[model samples]
Target: MNPTATLVLNNGKSIVIELLPEAAPNTVNSFIFAALNGVYNQHAIERIVSGNWIDMSYSAFHNEKAKYLIPYESQLHPEIEPLPSIAGCVCMGGYDELGLSGCEFFFTLRDCPEHRGVYPVFGRVIEGIDELYRLEKVKTKPITDFPYKNVEINEPIQPEIIRKVEVDLKGFKYDRPIKLPSQVLPKCWAMEYR
Candidate 1:
């Protein structure tokens, strides 16, 4: 399928993300379901690691919450061979063998090919990447400090709220229905009499 795109925080400033269904179908489907169900509304970017990515708490604020874990459907398609977790790429959170993380996701700010096999890459920032870059460059100080062991921490940091997630179907243009390339019938199939 031609990947879908979504614009969030529509009040003036917004962030646009292009969902890659072919690369990460499960992750894209989950994100779409969450958006349609109002899961992203009021959700905060809870965690931000400088030069790493921004992680948002999706299930925490949602009414139903993400109760079940979708299997890790990473870069399986040959078309998306060796997907790279580059800057602006949205990826799924990792979990233990139990499979628990529901709402957490990260957006890469640099090419981290090391994470290709470890993380499921689902989407990319087609627009508003400048805003994301700004957020990543923000100066963050630890909220707490412990002298002896040198333990530092921070919390309650507000990045940016996703006011709403809306899919712009008008932006996508797929020439054909999503199917395996092998399943595509030849053009001559329509001229049976020939």
Candidate 2:
């Protein structure tokens, strides 16, 4: 039986995601842990970058578990899972930093070739890609609720809520969280804009 998670939205919409355990065991396990533990309930879809991806905020319940970071498990380990960051694929947000609130994640609205090796692609939306589109098109603007005078982050005017996250393993083995070096400093690089 395949590993799957059903995200029941408040609007009565449900999105099902097919997880890849063999390819991203730790990432999948982390997701399962949070979903089954009620971490995703009432969580908001924080941002939807036009024609790019829809980013969701991490549930408050994930604070402690977020300390454990899921390594970038993708094509780099083709023997396990080599799926790319294409449309409908779910990817863990952030880079290089381990324990830095690994709660934010995004769903690709269109093919994301640039994110190929940057994030961990753990699963894909098997059903309700259309529902994701509806969420992606929600009206948004600079988040006035938070203080970010320098950097601008667009947030939905009416947040899309994930009422619940239900996981169905169907007899799949659950792996422990992937433990990695947590105190690694984020690398900084200067990029020249054309």
Candidate 3:
């Protein structure tokens, strides 16, 4: 049986994601580890782009610079086809050089061709899509201070929170991913710009 994860949001809603191990085995395992270990707990949903997607775990990674360091599982093997970025698709977020965020993930709001291969898709939201849509309606504002190069990060004024994460791994083996020393991002550099 395939493993699954349910993200319980503070808004009393849950987003169930069906992890595709065949597509991204390590990504799935690492995500499952983070979810089960409270790495994703009590964090605010920080970034949102209307008609694009919602983001989390970026700011959290910066705040606490160390966590499970996993590779881009979808790209690990040529045979493992990465999922396309479609509505409700979940993916890891970060850059190629600096490396992807250990636990940072996002859900696409629509089919994003520009996002193909940019973010390795590992799973898709199987439930609570409506909840994601509802959360999208929250008021947001872009950071006027930071000079973000790429995608505009319209942060939620009253950020939503991931209250808890529950996973049913179905006994999947999740060996602890390698832990790396804290990285100091270059001046004027952040994951959002990548």
The most accurate candidate by lDDT is 3
Per-prediction count of colliding residue pairs? 0, 0, 0
- Tens digits of per-residue lDDT for model 1 on 1-194? 44555546524567778788777765676676666667677665555667777766423343444434554553234455536899889887655343323345678878888878567787888788887776776566554322224322222354566777786545554331222223322221222312
lDDT of 3 by residue, 18-105 (tens): 9887877666766776776677888888788878888874554453433434555544566766677889899887656555556778
Full-model lDDT for every candidate:
0.59, 0.68, 0.73
Q: Rank the candidates by TM-score, best first.
A: 3, 2, 1
lDDT for 68 (candidate 2): 47
Say which prediction, candidate 2 or candidate 3, comes out ahead on TM-score: 3
TM-score of predicted structure 2: 0.79
* TM-scores of the candidates in the order shown: 0.70, 0.79, 0.85
Whose TM-score is greatest here? 3
Residue range 39-80, candidate 2, lDDT tens digits: 678777766777888877533233444444555664225566
Off by over 4 Å in 2: 58-62, 74-81, 97-103, 144-152, 181-194
